[model samples]
Target: MTRKHIDCRSFPSEINCSIAISADTDRELLEAAVQHAVAVHGHHDTPELRNQLRGAIMDGPPTEEQPAR
Candidate 1:
């Protein structure tokens, strides 16, 4: 799997930021990651947010649930 560039200059208060997702990564995915960081990590402002998203790159695509085959 490869990585993509994520422009996360939206919030502006993150640290050691990196989306760790892909550029093509959707809003829901991005939101989930950011929310996770904000909720879990100490991302409260622009810098922190930025850091938390600086090298943001996608590791793998998200997975959806499925019934037993």
Candidate 2:
């Protein structure tokens, strides 16, 4: 299994936390992870959070790159 970190900034408030998951390289898995993060974490309806997750997925697994390339 692979893992990736989702960075969340803390400026106005200090609660810097990184979400680490078995790195998802596909859209479906990525979508599931994003939904889980939003529902489990307190990042619902947040564009930044969604973008960050999408970016992480795009970054791809350490052993492989996105097929779209």
Candidate 3:
């Protein structure tokens, strides 16, 4: 199966979060993202938040970036 990924660098953040997560399944990716959002980004764990995270899911592995601004 094609891997899925999510990148914090895609979004604008004051902390300049550079985390990139990849997984073999949606369930795994969502769990990791939820933990990151709550523990680091100070976001609450909720269905709405999970939905947003699910929306951000990418089709394949993440690519390298220049840097976060």
Cα RMSD to the true fold for all candidates:
11.0, 7.7, 2.4
Please report the candidate that would top lDDT against the real structure. Answer: 3
- Runs off by more than 4 Å, candidate 1: 1-25, 45-55, 62-69
Cα lDDT for residue 45, candidate 2: 55
Q: Total clashes, candidate 3?
A: 0
Ranking by TM-score: 3, 2, 1
- What are the TM-scores, per candidate, against the unseen true structure? 0.36, 0.40, 0.89
Q: What lDDT would candidate 1 get against the real structure?
A: 0.46
- Could you give candidate 3's per-residue lDDT for residues 6-61 as a string of tens digits? 89987787898889999999999999999999999999999999998898888889
Residue 34 deviation, candidate 1, in Å?
1.1
Which window of 10 residues has the lowest lDDT sum in candidate 3?
A: 60-69
lDDT of 1 by residue, 1-69 (tens): 243334333334446333333444444445555665667565564665545554454345422422111
List the candidate numbers ranked by lDDT, top first: 3, 2, 1
lDDT of each: 0.46, 0.49, 0.89
Q: After superposition, how far is residue 35 of candidate 2 from its true place, in Å?
A: 1.5
